[model samples]
Target: MFNLFKDESQSVNSFFLFMQSLANRNLVAEALKVSEAKYRSLLENMGLGVIYLSNAGTVISANQVAGQIMGLPLNNMVGRALTETCSRIVKEDGSVLAHEQHPAMLALRTGKPVENVVMGLFNHAQQDHTWVMSSSVPEFLPGEREPHQVFMTLTDITRRKRVEEESSLASVIVNNTGEGIVVTDQDNKIISVNPAFTILTGFSRQEVLGKRAHCFQSPKNAIKIDEALRNSRKNGNSWQGEIWHRRKNSDDFPCWTTINQVKDATGRTTHHVYVVMDITHLKKDQNRLGFLAYHDPLTKLPNRMLLKDRINHALQNARREGSQVAVLFLDLDRFKIINDTYGHAVGDGLLKEVATRIKNLVRKEDTVSRYAGDEFIVFMEDVSDTKSPATLARKLIETFNIPVEVKGHTLQVTTSVGISLFPRDGDDSDSLIKNADAAMYRAKKEGRNNFQYYRPELTTQAFEKMAVETELRQSIDKRELVLYYQPRVCLKTGNIAGIETLVHWQHPVMGLIPPARFIPVAQESGFILALGEWMVEAACRQMRCWLDERVPVNKIVVNVSAFQLLRSDFLATVERILREHELSPHCLELEINESSLMDNAEHIIKALNGLADAGMDLTIADFGKGYFSLINLKRIPAKKLKIDRSFVSEMLCNSNYEAVIRSVIALGNSLNLQVIAQGIESEAQKDKLIEMGCNLGKGDFYFPPALPDAKNLTKLMS
Candidate 1:
C-alpha cells in the first residue's frame, strides 16, 4: 500500500510540469503573431502597394494598398504572380523585361531597393494601368544562399508626371509670347510676371510681386479698373477690354487686357491670369484714320460729312438744353476774281488761310466745316442769348475786311455770311443748310460783304422753286411747253430785224405758265439740254416756215442755258437741228447769259469757237447784271450784248442805271457789236434806250409771246 501512493505522487508532479511548458509555448506564439500583425499594419498604411512573392514567382502575401492600387483584394491576390497575366509583363522593344533588368526582379535578385522604375500593370477587368516607382527586396533564411521570399513596393505617379509636363508647356508659352503675361492670386495681388510685362509697364518681376494689380492704374481713369475687376470676379468669367494704365515713369498709356480665373481640381479658384497688349500707338493710328475719314485734307477742318454729324449732335444738345443753335454759311464774294487773276493755286491758298482765320474766330465748342468750294459752315450751339449770333456774325464780317496775302499778291476778299437758327428758321440739317445757303445768296444779291438771317418768306420761295423744278422734268413729256417768238425790230426802218424765240408752258390744267415759271427749273434739273434742243429746233422750223411764206425775218434768236452751252456736243446738236429744218446757221442766233461765260471762261471760249466756226452768231443776254472780265469777253465770239430788264426799267428815273446802260451801249458800239435791250416795257424806257444808241429792242411792250399761227404772227410783227 506504501509503494502505490509514491507512484501516484510522481505522476501528478510530471503532469503539472507538462502543463507549465505548454503554457510558455502558447505565450511565445501569441507574442510573435502580435508583432507580425503590427509590421503588416505599418506596411499597409504606407499608401504604397506591397506584394510578397515566393522564390518560384508565386504570390505569397499582399497588403491592402497593393490590392487597392491594382484594383484587387489582398486575400484574392495572394498566391498569384503578376507574370501569370502575359499582358501584365513589361517589355522593352518586343521582348519581356529580363528578370535581372526588371525593377522588382532586380531588387529581388540583388537584394537591394529599386528606386524609381516605371512599369505597366494589367487586370482582366480593368485593362492596362501605369505605375511610376517599384521596389523588391529578398527575404531569406538566416544563413541560406538562396532567397525563399521577395517583398515588392509599388507607387502610382502617372498623374504627377502629366502635371509636370503641362507645367513645362505653360512655362514655355509664357516666356516666348509677344504679349505681356501676369499671374495674380484671387485677391488681385501679383504672383509672377513675364518679360513683356517689364517692357510694357517698366516694372520688374520682383517689384510687382505681391503688389495689387491696380498699383499701375492710370490717374486719369483709375475708377474703371476696380469696376472691371468686380464685374469679372462676380460673373466667374473672363474680362477682355481696353484700359488706361500708367508706366513706371508715370506716363499714361492704353493697353488691352484679358483676365481669367484659374481653378483647382476641387473647382476652387486659385489665381487670376492677365494677358496684356500695349495699344497706344494702335489707338493713335485709329484716331488718325477716323479723322481723315470725316475731315477735309486741304483745309484740315470738318468736311460736309463731319459737319452733318456735328450738326446732328449739336441739335440734340440744344434741344435737351432748351436752347437755340445757329448755322452760319459763308461764301466768298470776290473769290472768283482772285481765282481768275492769280490762278487756282493762289485761290486755294487763300481759301486755306481764310479757313484758319475763321476757325480762330469761333469758340472751341463751335464746329467749323468746309461746306463746299469757297464756302464754309459754322455751327454755333447754345445761341439762345439775344443778338449774340448777329454780333458774332458782324464780327466775322469785319474780320474779313483785311486783305489776304497769297503767293506774293495782296488780294482783297469779302465773305457773305447767312444765318439760320434751330426751331425758328429750320428744324433739320437739310432745311437749315438750305435756308442758310439761300440767305447767303441773298446777301450776295444785296451787294455782298454782309450777314443776314434767313426769312420765312425765303423758305416759302425755296419750296416754290422746288415745285417749279419738279414740274419742269415732266413738262416736256406732258406736252406742257411751247415756243413763242417776238420780232426784234430795227429802230431806223421799223422793220422786223429778227425774231427772238422764247419758251413758255401751256400747262394742261394750270393754264399758261410763263417762261419764268419753268426756266429756273430747267436750269436746276440739268434738263436745260433737252429744252434747249427743242427751242433750237422749233425756232429753226418756224424760221423756215416764215421763209416758205415769204415773210422777211432775217434771223431767229433762241435762248440757250449755260448747261447746254457747256456741252461739247452742243454745236453738233445745233447743226443737226439746222439740217433737219433746212435752215441756215446765219439765220439763227444763240442768246447766252453773261453769268455763264464768266463762270466757265475756258470751256465757254472753246464752245464759242466751235459755234463761230459753224457760222452761228452769239449774243450775250443780261450783260450788265454780271461782272464782266473785259479780257475774257474779247475772246468770246458774241455779235451783240442784250441789256437786261433791270437796267432799262429805271433808266429814266435813275441816272446811275442810265449811265450804266449808255456805257454798255457805247462799249458794244466800240466793239463792233449790236446792243439789244430786252424787257422794254414802257415807251419811255424804249425811247431812252434808243437815244442811248441801242440797236434793237424786244419785250412785252412790243409784243407778248405769240402762238405759231399766221394771225398771231401778224400781231407779233405789228
Candidate 2:
C-alpha cells in the first residue's frame, strides 16, 4: 500500500511537473507567434523595403515592400536567387555589380554589415531602372559559424538620384551660358557664381562669394537695387531692369539684370538668383539714335524738328513769365546765286560757317536752326521788348560783315532778318514762322541786308496783294479786265493824235479798281507778264476795230512792265498778238518806263531794236525820274520820251520841278526824241508844256481816261 501510494505521489508529482512544463511551453509559443507577427508587420508596413536572403544569395523571404521595390511577386521572389532576381544591379557609375559584390551577398561573404550600398535595379514590371540605397546584416542560426541569411533594408531613392542629375546639368548650363548668373542666400550675400559671372564682372567666385550683391553695384544705384529687391520680395516675384554696375577695376558698366526668388515648398524665400546681361553697347546705340534725330548732320546744330520743339517749350515759359517771344526768320541774300556759281560743296561750307557765326551771336538759351535752303531761324525767349530782337538782328548782321573764307574764296554775305513776336504776329509756331517769312519778304523788297518786324499794316497789304493775285489769275479767263483809253492830243492843233491804252478791272462786287491798286501787286506777284500780253492783244484788236470802223486814230500806246520787256519771248508774243488781231504793227506803240530801260540797258537796246525793226513805235515813259546816263539814253531806240506826271503836275507850282521839266524837254529834243507831257489838266499847263517844246499832251484838260468803247472813243476823236 505504501509503495502504491508512493508511486501515485511520484506519478502525480511527475504529472504536475509535466503540466507546469507544458504550460510554460504553451506561453513561450504564444509569445513567439506574437513576435513573428510583429516583425512581419514591421517589415511589410514600413516605408523601407525589407528582404531576407540565404547564404547562397537567394531570396529566402521578402516583405510586401521588398517585392514591390524589386518589381516581383512576393511568392516568386522568396524562392528566387537574389543574384538572379537582381541581376540588373549596377553601381552608381552604371557598371554591373557581380553577385559577390551585391549588398546581401557581400554581407554574407564577409560576415559583416553593409551600409548605404547605392545601386540600380531593373524593374521588369515597370520596364525601367530604379535606384535604391541598400544596407545588409548577416544572420546565422544558433551555434552556426557561417551566416545563413542576409537581412537587408532597401530605400527607393530614384527621385533623389534624378534630382541630383538634373542639378548637375543645371550647374553645367549656368557655368557656360553667356548671361551671367549669381546665387545669393536669404541675407542677400553672394553664395555662388558661375564662370560667366566671373567673365562679366571681372571678379572671380572666390572674390565675390559671401559679399553683399550691392558691392558690385555703383554707389548711385546700390540703394535703388536694394529698394527694388525689397519690393520684389514683398510682391513674391522677380524684378528685371537696367542697372549700372561697377567692376573689380572700379569701372562702371551698364547691365540688364533680373533677380528671382527661390522658395521652398512652404513658399519661404530661401535664396535669390540673379541673371545679368551686359547692355553697354545697346545704351550707346540708343543715345546715338536720339542725337541724330534732333541734330543736323552737316552743321551739328539743332534741326528744324528740334527747333520747333524748343520754340514750343520757350513759348510755354514765355507765357508763364508774361514776356514776349520772338522768332527771327533769316535768309542769306543772293544765296541762290552763290549756290549756282560756287557749287554745292562750297555752299555747304558757307552754310556751316554761317551756322557757327549765328550760334556765336545768340545767347545760350536761344536756339538757331537751319530752316531750309539758305534759310535759318532764331528763337528768342523771355524778351523784355521788341528792341531785344532788333538788337540781336543788328548783331547777326554785323557778324556777316566779315568775309568768310570758304574753299579759298573770301565771300562776303548778308542776311535779311524778319522778326515776328508771339501774341502779336502769331500765337503758334506755324503762324509765327509764316508771318516771319512774310516780314522777311518785305525786308528783301525794302532792299536786302536789313531786318523788319511784322506789322499789321504789312499783313493787310499782304492780304490785299494775295486777293489781287487770286483775282488776276482768273481775270483773263473771266474777261473782267477791260481797256480804257486816254486821248493824246496834238498841242498845236488841239486834236487827238493818239490813244493810250490802260487796263481796268471791272470787279463784280467792288466798283472799278484802279491800276494803282493792282499794278504793283501784279508786278511783284509775277502776273504782269500775262497782263501785259493781254493788254497788247486787246489794244491791237481795238485798233483793228477802229480801222474797220473808219475812225481816225494815229497809234495805240500800251504800257509795258519791266518783267514783260525782259521776257525772252516778248517780241514773239507781240508779233503773235498783232497777227491774231489782224492789225498793222505800225498802228501800235510800246511804252517802257525809264527804270525798265535803265535796269538792263544792253538787253533793253536789243529788245527796242527788235520792236523798231518790226515797225512798232517805242517810247520811254517817266523819263526824268530815273538815274539814266546820257550815254544809255542815247543808246535807247525810243522815238519819244514822256515827262513824268510828278514833273508835269508840279511845273506851275515848284520852279525846281518846272526847271527839271524844261531840262528833260531840252534833253529829249537834243536826243532827237519827241517829248510828250502827261497830266496836262489845265490849258495853261498844256500851253506851258507847248512852250517847253512838248509836241504832244494828254490829260483831263483834253479828254479824261474813258472806256475804249467805240462810242466814247469816236466822240473824243470828233
Candidate 3:
C-alpha cells in the first residue's frame, strides 16, 4: 500500500509540468502571428516596388506597387513559377539574360547571395520592359549546409534610369554645338562651360571654373551684368543682340549673345545662362563688301557711284559755304586704238600709270574716279575760282605728256579733259556730269590732249535740237525704231521673270541712240504719245511671236512716259494695239515712273486702276526716288514696286541705303506687292538683295539690254 501511494504522486507532478509547457507554446505562436501581420502591412504600404521569388523561381508574394510596376496582378503570380520562357529577361546592357545569370537562379545554384543586380524584365500588361535593381539572398533552415530557397527582392528603377539616359544625351549635345554655352551661379561665378566656350574664349574649364564670369576681359558695357539681370527679371525678357566681348588673346570681337536668367518659383534669381555666337566674320564680310561697293577693284579709286555721292556731298558743302566746286570729266584719247594694238594687258598697265599720275596731281580734298571703260572723272571741292580749275586742267593735260612705260612697252598716252563748274555750268551732279561729258567730246573734236570749259549753248543749240526732233518724229516708223529687251530674272535661280522693253533709234550716223539721249526731246515735243503707241504695238507683235514659238517669257514690260499717261486716249491705244495682235492684256505689264504718280494722281490712279482691273500688271518705277504720301501710294493700283538702281548698288556698303532698301521691301511685303530690285551688278549684290527679300532683278550682270534671238530666248527661259 505504501509503494502505490509514491507512484501516484510522481504522476501528478509530471502532468503539472506538461500543462505549463503547453501554455508557453501558445504565447510564442501568438507573438509570431502578430509580427508577421506587421511585416506584411509595412511592405504593402511602402513606396518601394517589392517582389519575392523562391529558389525555384516561383513568385511567392508581391506588394501592390510591384504588381503595378510589373504590369501583372500579384494574385496571379502567387502560385506560379517565373520560368525563363514566362518573360523576356535581359541584362543591364540589353543583352538577353540566360537562366543561370538571373539573380534568383545564381543565388540558389551557388548557395550564396546576389545583391543589387540591374535587370530588365518584360511587363505582361504594359507590354514593355520593366527595369529593376534586384537582390537574391539564399536562406538556410536551421543547420542545413545549402540553401533550399532564395529570397529574391526587386525594386523598380525604370524612371531613374530614363532620366539618366536623357541627361547623358543632353550632355553630348551641349558639348558639340557651335555656339557657346555658359552656366553661372547667382553671384555670376562661372560654374560650367561647354567645349565651344573654351574654343571661343581660349579659356579651359580648369582655368575659369569658380571664377567670376568675364574676369579676364572687360566689355564696353556696364561693369556689372547684374543690372542687366535685374532689368530682365523686371521686364520678363532676355537681354539679346550684339555686344562686344574680348578674347583671351586681348582681341575684341562682336558676338550675338542672349543673357537668360533662371529664377525659382518665388522669382528669386538663382542662375544665368549665356548663349553666345561670334559674329566677327560677319562684320568683316560687311566691311569688305562696303569697300568693294564704293571703290573700283582695278584702279583702287572711287567708282562712278562713289563719285556721284562725293559730288552730292561737295555740292551741299559748296552751297552752305559759298564755294565753287569744279568737275572735270576725262577721256583717254585713242585708248581703244592702243588697247587693240598692244593687247589689253599693256593697255591696262598704261591706264594704271595714268591713273596714279592723275590721282597724285589732285588736291587732298578732290576726288578721282574710274567712271567707265577708259574714262576717268575728277571733282574738286572748295575751289577758289574758275581759274583754279582751268590751271588744274592745264596741269592734268601736261602731266600725261610724258610717255608712260608699261609692261616693257613704250607707250604715249594722252587725255581729253572737260571742266564744268558747280552752280555755274550746272547745278546738280547729273547735269554737271552730262555737260562735262559733252565738253570732253568737244575737246576730242577740237584736238586730242587739250582741256575745254563747259558751254551750255554748245550742248544742243535750238536749231540742232529742232533738227533732232524732226528726225525723231520721222523715225517713229517701223524701220527706224527698234525694241530692245532686258529680262528681270530671279536673283536666286537666274530664271527670267519678264521682258522689259526699251526703245532704241537705229540712227544711220549715231549707230544706236539710247532713249536717254532722245526721250527728253520726245517728251517735250508731245511726240511720246505717238512713240508710246508704236512701242506698245511692236511689243505686242513680239509677244505674239514668242507665244507662237512657245517661248516661256510670261509678260512684256513696256515703258510708259508721263506724256502717254497724261493723254486721255492712252488706255484705248494700248487696248487697240493688243486687239490688233490678238494678245492678252495680262501678258503686257506697263511701267510708269514713280514721279508720274504725283502729276495728276487722281487721273493717273483712275487710268491705272482701269488697266489693273483689265488684268494688266502696273509697276511703279524708281519707287524710292519719288516723294508721295502713303495715301497716294495706296490709292494707285499697282502690282509691283521697282526699287531704284541707286539703292541696290550701295545697299551692301551703306547702312543708310540698306535701311532704305529694307524699309521698301518691308513696305512692299505689307502691301502685298512684288518688290523688284534694279542693277543687280555683282553676285554679292544679287545675294544681298535676295537675302533682303527682293527676288526679281534686272541688270547687265545677267545680260545687257538687247534684242534676243528666238533660240537664246528659249534657252534663257528654259
Candidate 4:
C-alpha cells in the first residue's frame, strides 16, 4: 500500500509538471476550453443580445437574448444564415434593407466596427415588428488580411422608438395649429411659441422668444389674466375665458384664451401652455345689435322704449331727491296743413328742425323723444317747481317763431305743450304722459301756440281752442287779418317819425279779436308765416298810399316774429315786397324782440347782417327782458334798442325801474344806437324817459293804435 501511494504521488507530480509546462508554453487545450466556456457564459447571460456570424453570412452562434430579440429559439438561431434569420429587417423608414447592408455584413466587408444601426425585426410569434439598435465588430485571425467572423450586439428598443415617433407627431400638430399656442417653463418664462402665435400677435419669434406671456396682455385685462393663470396653476387645471390682448402695434383686441398646466409624472407642474383666438368681430356685432335695439333709426335719438326707461329712472331719482319730474307732451299745431301744402318732404324737414330746436333748449339731463307723427315727449328730472316746465314750454313755443325753410318754402310750426308734474298730476311714467297728453289737447283748444298744465278744468278749454284753431285756419283764406298802425312821434322833432304795423284778427263771429288772442292761434296753426308775408306786402302798399297822400310819416316799422326772421329767404321776401309797392328799403324798419335774436344768435346774426346790408333798418324791441350777452349785442347789426313796455310802464312808481330805463338809454347811446320807449301812458313816465336821454317815445299817451288810414296819420301829426 506504501509503494502504491509512492507511485500515485509521483504520477501526481508528473501531472503538475506537465500542466505547468503546458501553462508555460500556453498550449493546454483544457485552458482554451475553460476560456471558451467563460466567454459563452458571459455572452448568454448579458443583458444585450449577442450573435456571432461567419464571414460568409451564416450565423455561428447566438445567445438567449439574441434569440429572444429575433423571436426564435437559441439553438434554432445557431448555424442559420444571419440574413435569412432577419430577412424582414427594415430601416427606420420601414423600407427593407438588403443583406449586404446589414450591420454584421458591413462590419465584415469593411473590416471595421459599426454601432447603433437601428433595424426592425419581424416577430413571427407576435406577428408584429420589433425595433432593435445593433452594433457589430469584425474578428480577424492572427496576421490575416480578411475578417473571419463578425460579432454583433443588439438591443430591443421598440418601446422607445414608438415613444419618439409619437412625440415627433405631437410636436408637428402643436406647431401648425390654427390657435395661437405659447409654452412657458416652470419659471413662467416663455420657452416656445407656435406659428399661429406669431401670426395672431403680429410678433416674430425673434422678438418674443424669451418674453413673459403677460407682456402681450393689454393693461385693461393684464391683472385679470394673471390671477386666472395663478388660480389655474394652483388647482392643476386649465383656465379658459375671454380677455383683451395687445398686439405689437399697440392695438388692443378681444381674444378667447386658454391656459393649461403641463405636469410631470409626480403631478408637479413643469410648464404652462397658452392658446388664444381673436373675438373682436364678435364683440362688435353684439354691441351693434344692443345699440340698434334702443335707438331710433331715422334721428338716432332715443325711441319710445328708451324714453320709458329714462322716465322710470328720472322718476326714481326725483323720488329720492324729494323733487319733482316734469313730463312735457307736445304736438305740432297745424303741422298737417303745412305737410299738405308742401308735400311730406317739407313736413319731414320741419319735424327734424323742431326736434333739433327742442333738444337745444333742454338741459343735458332731459330726454327729448319723438313719440310719433309730429308728437314729442320731454322728460325733465329734479324740476324745482312748475316754473321750470313753464319756462321750457315757453322756450319751445318760441322756437317755432323762427321759420324752417324747406326747399325754398318758408314753413312755420308751433307746439302745443302740456306739462304734468310728478306727485302733483301723476306719479308713474304712463300716468304722467297720459295726463300731459290730455293737457296738450287742452292747450290746442285754448290756443294752438301756447302751453298748459295738466288740470281737470283744462280739458273743456282745450276743446274750445281746437274749435278756434279751425276757425283761425279759415280766417287766413278769408283775408280777415288786417294791419293796424301805431304812430311814433319823435321826442326831439314832435313829428310822426314812423308807424308801427300790427296784426288784428277780424273773426266774423267773434267780432274784432285782439292781436294777443288769435295771433297765437294763427302762429300755432302755421298761418303766422303766411299772415306775416301778407302784412308785409299790405304795409308796404299802405305806406306807398300814405306817401301818395303826402302824410308826415317817413318810415313803416313792422314787428317781425321769430318765425319770420328764421326764414332763409326772408331778406328776399322783404326786398320783393318793397319792390312790388315801389317803396324805398330805407322807409321800412324791421322790429325784432331781443329774446328772439338771442334764441339762435349765430343764425340771427347772419340774417340781421343781411338785412342791414340791403339798406333796411333793424330794431331790437323789448331789449331789457332777454338775457343777452354784451358780446352778442355787439354782434347784432341793429340801429335801435327799444325799452320794453314793462320797464317803461312801472318807471314812475319804482326807482329801480327808472334806473333800468336810464341805464338802457346810456348803453344804447354809448353803442351809437337810437333808444325808443314804448307804453309811456303817463306824462310822468314820458318826462322821466326824456330826462334819461331817450331818442323816441310812443304809447297810448300819444295816440291809440288805429287803422292804417289817412285820417289817423293826420291826427298823430297834429
The prediction achieving the highest lDDT against the true structure is 2
Task: Order the candidate numbers by TM-score, best to worst.
Answer: 1, 2, 3, 4
User: Which of 1 and 3 is ahead in lDDT?
Assistant: 3
TM-scores of the candidates are 0.55, 0.52, 0.47, 0.45
For candidate 2, list the clashing residue pairs, or say none. Answer: none
Q: Pick the candidate with the highest TM-score.
A: 1
Q: What lDDT score goes with residue 189 in model 2?
A: 97
Off by over 4 Å in 3: 1-158, 169-184, 189-214, 217-227, 241-257, 274-283, 297-299, 303-305, 331-355, 372-375, 387-418, 440-718
lDDT of 2 by residue, 439-505 (tens): 8878987977999999877777667667778987898999899998999888999887789988889
Weakest ten-residue segment in model 1 by summed lDDT: 85-94
lDDT of each: 0.81, 0.86, 0.83, 0.84
User: What is the C-alpha lDDT profile of model 1 across 1-718, one tens digit per residue?
Assistant: 6889899999999999999999999999999899898988888788887788887777787777677667676666777765653245453233456555766666567766667666656544566565456777888899987778778887877577568768988898889888888888978899999998998889998999999988887878744767877777777667878888889999999888888889899977798888889998899999999998998878989999989988888888878888888889999875754565457899899989999999889999899998888899999988856477788888788888888888887777788989998978887888899999888867876878898889978767767767777877788788787887787876655577888877888877688888786775575456777888888887888888878977777888898876776666889999998998888889988888888776546767788878988999999989988897988878888899998988888888899999999999999998898998888788787778778889888777777668768596766454
RMSD in Å for all candidates = 14.5, 17.4, 22.8, 22.1
In model 3, what lDDT does residue 54 have? 69
Q: Residue 536 error for model 3, in Å?
A: 32
Give the range of the ten consecutive residues with the poorest summed lDDT in model 3. Answer: 216-225
- Residue runs of model 4 more than 4 Å from their true location after superposition: 1-369, 377-435, 438-453, 710-712
